[model samples]
Target: MNGRSFSSSVRVGNWNEDVSLDEDLLKDFLEKREKGELLVQRSSNLNKNVLQKAELSISKDGFLHFGEMVMLLNPENSEQSLSNPSPVYGNYTLSVNPDESAIHVKSHLTAPCGVSASSNVKPCGRNAFIITSVDGSEPGEPLCYGQNFALRTTEEFMGHLYLTSDRKSFLKSSKKSHLQEVSLTDQDSFETCWQVVYMDPQLRLEHEGLPIPANTKVLIIHSKTNQCLAVLRKYILWTLFGKECEITAHTYLNGHRVEENENHWIIVTGNPSDDINTMFDRPKPLSEDINGS
Candidate 1:
């Protein structure tokens, strides 16, 4: 040891192996870490708080609303709306008919001063229902009913709706089956059901290969060709120029997208304690009781 270090020389060792032997560079690196500039900072874009707007929602009481507009029967019992007052026209309340699996859209609005009421009413106009024809294969019509119209669902969430005339048949299979009003009693009638598809948060009624496009004039087209479904477009027909307009649903499809909004639909009822099975399964109509099967 004395021979090797006779001159007594000392050397300093560098501890930072990554740095270029510069103190300034090491200082700059440490400063960047403290300021959160060098390492990946928490990205706000990935963790942004986005607010969503209120969209179409069905209540437990079977009341469907798009924002402030409620879907219901026209006071005049008409099928389509042409001019004013149509946007706000609709039944105030819509409930599910346990006896018939269809929805009953009722209106309490008064008719025009001289306009006659076609449906029976107690001062108020008659009630209408959202129903399809016997065989959904063809675009069905929304007709006026007394108690309620018969509508049946083939599945949960993304399912098909069938309109029955005498609680024995449903409108199913748009073009393929030639849109015939086949009786549910027939096994082939099972194919008559329409498909409820929710795409981009918008609800669409599709039958076999045909799609029901929604428009302000009509909830759906009579066919894929965009023929408007024929119905009595009811209005107040009041003497007042402003009051003579019709009331109809302005929104049919969703303006915004939802993850499961269109794909899912639940049976709504006033009785919160109602059993799901009983609500859906009545004594007259069996689960497979499509078209009165």
Candidate 2:
């Protein structure tokens, strides 16, 4: 995935320099707010030190863009952040794509997920720009999961990677599980953005009479490894060969989430065989440490 450009040190208010705080602690501050904690206090002190070092950017109509960063003036004291005294690190870029949607995101934090967090809308102020991730080779094999599209074409709204697989079955018949995925589109076929994956909750052994759900919520589990996969976003129900079924899929995470959430319409991509991500949970906002969103 692309690293955002909102990484530069920005003033929280009137501070002259950027104070160092724990990445994890800062993440927790965003995750759970705490009023007092030596570490949390130090973090707050540091944030207090960074306030508009450079002129804040604003749009002509007075709307914030994606690259623009916000400083936490008086970050709300939530169970997530108040647990510690470290400076608040959560930040977000208020951006709107004319064709897409108006989203306030750093996308997500550096980790798979930390915890659910909330911030006062007015207490936050503009600060810096979004820092972009390095453009180069990827870490693991490309797939339809992760922010990078693992191995698909349509980058932005058109996530063709997840659907563009000619083969219907990537996994072996010997294996059986509560859910499964099969490719339904081709790399060249230009279809709508939404995807469809057929699955059955209780599949019979030997791949016989496997019944995947048509509108059921399922994690887009990987094939070879069977590790926890991304959560399917859009869901719909349809018929197959005179039988009822469910189709689902989602934009997988790039191995990072604030914290796990249920029914959070998000998919995670990683090896199911190995250690990667947690199962599905209620959709919760990511940690608010580094960039308070």
Candidate 3:
């Protein structure tokens, strides 16, 4: 007689009844649940008013809009390599804080720099950043190409931090010509202003007056220096959050031979509902039936 094959889903006996969880296992599970360590659905804890504001800030088409919380992503550093062994591919977002002193550079200790050591002065040397419109447009207004904006830190305790590039910070090293340091300042000045430019120059006329799509690569130019904002992949700095890539403003030229990819950045934005819900939700109970009833 030929043997018959059974499907994996075929239930021959009461598996649930045959196996049982032990007392220690049950106790551990309960403890984890009580500590909110269990893998379970939870409700959001964000204030209703804040959630409403965030919802209003998001554009209908989901394009990057003014006043929206945005993170600038460097595409060149988005991948893991032998040099960049960190598994945080695409996770190293551009972030900034009020405490500008938190940035510690390895080269600053030895290099004879003209930068001032005043406590009041903060150099944009490899500091974190956040994107916002400088035009004073409404939060829901879409960011258009060639629009002016500021890269600011979320910290407002002392004052708003703006990413600034000026002629004084310009450097000409043996390797290339670029802005040596991008500093942070509490004051809003012309030096802190930057403009968004299309990565492909051909797209300029087509996308004029149109909203910039989220997650698309673009170039940011410092309005004052006329140099493109770039990430110094080789220059890593230590921050309170650990090691992070450095940022600078550089004009890439055929003569200078600077890599153009350094200037490319992607604007990343989160869904308003998801971000709000995750911050302020309550835990949801498990379903009564393991299998659909």
Candidate 4:
């Protein structure tokens, strides 16, 4: 105590080294902390707002007039946010049947992707159904397209329509099988008709009835390759009587309007000079159905 300078200390109170920096240093540290908290709060708020506004985004429907996507509007600046392309919706399918009775539609929804389908029943005249279906392989909301789906409708008259969707891979294992069936006839008839309908692309008839029968309500199809080739109509039966015109000439003479002794069904008629020649004649009698399995 006599030789050395002594230092006197009472007691040291609690002091944190980190908080006990110089005044300027302390202020700078506090500012940095405050700024970090502010940034986190702002980011969180932006995410909440974006989620709330997602429905208005173009991805659900389409792009807005300003060319901004819905999901990207509120995302914090990032690479994905900058280079993102516009949004797109998913796809679906719809189809109908013949005889104006049933319809089918389909769509799907998965963990990462979803789809839906619906359809409308309709009167598919003359032609047979081939299990017309829709496919939605793209992203976003599901939509559909038809086999003969053109912007311009090509038919004498459009009939009843049905809409449906069977997505989610829940309905059937369609993804597993590529083979499908389109049949309007009894199973027993499939074998006999397959020769006439399936194997033959031209529907080769073995000197058979061209106009079909009244009981023949549907043309059996393979549910694929629905094309327009041979044509048929009920009124064409009269043309057959032309070969018998000489035989039925007496009947025609009596039954036809005696004004010119011609067969006039509707309000229209052309010259009766061999008008029957314009119609196709049966090279063979239309007596039996086709042959083969």
Candidate 5:
């Protein structure tokens, strides 16, 4: 998904740089706004930081594309050079083929996924997540419950990961979840862009109400604030058919840690085995301090 480009006249704006969008799509967007069919959400400080660094846009033909969405996972209140603050390292790319209705992901992080052995040069594993639309649906269409397929292909399409509307946490899925992808126009499909963050441990646990320990990470959607958390949990569910489990999520709150109307969720990683309960019972947290240097 490198070197992706956008039409100059499309309705959606690019997050990273100022680009001319499609004229017709822009006109339609204006008409929709005048009719109250389109609502532009105000950007937050977090949104500003991300928008300045990443490129995200929606095409007139309804294709959503993302270019270079990145976040520096530095600790809060850390003193460092403006030119060189060390960031927690991670690389994630989300993309899809035009002829297919599935969303494909390539994720690599500083933390080890345990499924692969580490090397001194590139220690972590290269993992993937695939969310195929439900059955009776054509390729390049939105995914639905019971209609989605997984593991049928050679690729290891894993479990469900849901992002909250507030773009704070990514929730793991339950056995009976209807994992569907939310399109740029709020429709369900393969087109999506998420923001990945390395949060402060204390803040993540306190503000998001998650037991993130130290190394657990998350990703968010770009541009649109209210995109549906894709229901790709079908692959995860299918892969993890039997095991002890617990759901986890990152929920975003409106005010300075307000409790009312707060949004949160919990999703499980699909890598656990039959001995998962025994594994969690020990609770071996990572040894290193991830609160960026």
Candidate 6:
């Protein structure tokens, strides 16, 4: 009706009447409907609007910025050995509410290593995350050490899936008693708040206001419980997608001091301007003492 030429004639009823129709338009509509292009086109348009609203950017200083898509990696176990084919070989990345669950159900948070299945497979991108400021900072603001932020899932359909630690998990008397179970929740409660800590002891004192560099190792400490977010190395579990590493909120302690290595994680992003090196070059202490807080 909009632009088609209605010159085609079609038989109508038994009155020998001729009806004018746009054959080309009718054919095009039928083809598009058969191929499901109409639904796809509408979905694509909606995604475009969502992407524009959630436009992410990087900082010139090569630091992790708020609202940027990132993958949390543990370098200690990132590599996969094809010859050995160990369950612990592949790189593990944090993921929230993976699509492995039943319809209308949300899965728990996990660190999936796609390469675990085969050495040829690349690390899974379902682990993508977005670091958003809990203090309502602008998206352009650089994420700094000791700043509180919320890790949110990037899936649009999942709505607001935030990384959260279950308080009830702390009461368990089993082997996992010290480890708080981490999961995805729609609520933005205190359990969703996490603070970034410098992994390097030197940086803890020297770099207070500097933005955390991308691909650098850092500690994510839960604000409410003062526990560090960690991937349970021994707790590999199977999911609908593949084998995934279990995540927890546990404070690794050597006597009264914090054990940094057990909870270390690297922030990986696709921002080309990021500095790939200098992850442990500097550090900053949390605004308040972790134990005292």
Candidate 2 stretches greater than 4 Å from native: 1-56, 61-67, 70-116, 123-293
Q: Candidate 5 lDDT (Cα, whole model)?
A: 0.25
lDDT of 4: 0.20
Please identify which of the two predictions, 2 or 4, would achieve the higher TM-score against the true structure. 2
Question: lDDT values of the candidates?
Answer: 0.25, 0.25, 0.51, 0.20, 0.25, 0.58
Tens-place lDDT per residue, model 6, 1-293, is 35423332434343232232345567888998776466555444433322232223334667898887666776554233444354465446665324332222222233321111111121233455688888989987888887888987666443557877755443641133345777776777787898888876555867666688876778888998888877665566565445666677776765647554457777765533244322322333565346432
Q: Which stretches of model 5 miss by more than 4 angstroms? A: 1-190, 200-219, 226-254, 257-274, 277-293
Error of 2 at 137 (Å): 16
Candidate 3: residue 98 lDDT (0-100): 17
Off by over 4 Å in 6: 1-59, 77-87, 97-101, 104-125, 169-178, 254-260, 271-293
Model 3: worst 10 consecutive residues (lDDT sum): 41-50
* Range of the 10 consecutive residues with the lowest summed lDDT in candidate 6: 113-122
In terms of lDDT, which candidate is strongest?
6
Which candidate, 1 or 2, has the higher TM-score?
A: 1
Q: After superposing candidate 3 on the true structure, give the runs of residues whose Cα lies further than 4 Å from its correct spot.
A: 1-59, 77-91, 97-131, 155-158, 169-178, 253-259, 272-293
Q: What is the lDDT, from 0 to 100, of the residue 11 in candidate 6?
A: 42
Please give the lDDT score at residue 65 for candidate 6: 87
Candidate 1 all-Cα RMSD: 25.4
- Report the lDDT of model 3 for residue 142: 75
Q: Residue 5 lDDT in model 2? A: 33
**Candidate 6, lDDT over the whole model:** 0.58
TM-score, prediction 6: 0.60
**Taking the tens digit of each residue's C-alpha lDDT, what string does model 4 give over 1-293?**
34313222322332343234445686876785676444445444333321221111122232111121111000011332356432111111111112201111111111111111111111112111111112222233222211111111112222212111111234432121211222122112211111112112244354232322111112222112332111111111111002101000001122332211111111001112342211111132345524310
Per-residue lDDT, model 2, residue 183, is 33
- For model 3 the local lDDT of residue 193 reads 90
| Model 3 TM-score on a 0 to 1 scale | 0.54
Q: How far is candidate 6 from the true structure (C-alpha RMSD, Å)?
A: 12.3
Q: Which RMSD values do the candidates have, in order?
A: 25.4, 23.1, 19.3, 30.3, 23.3, 12.3
> Clashes in candidate 2: how many?
87
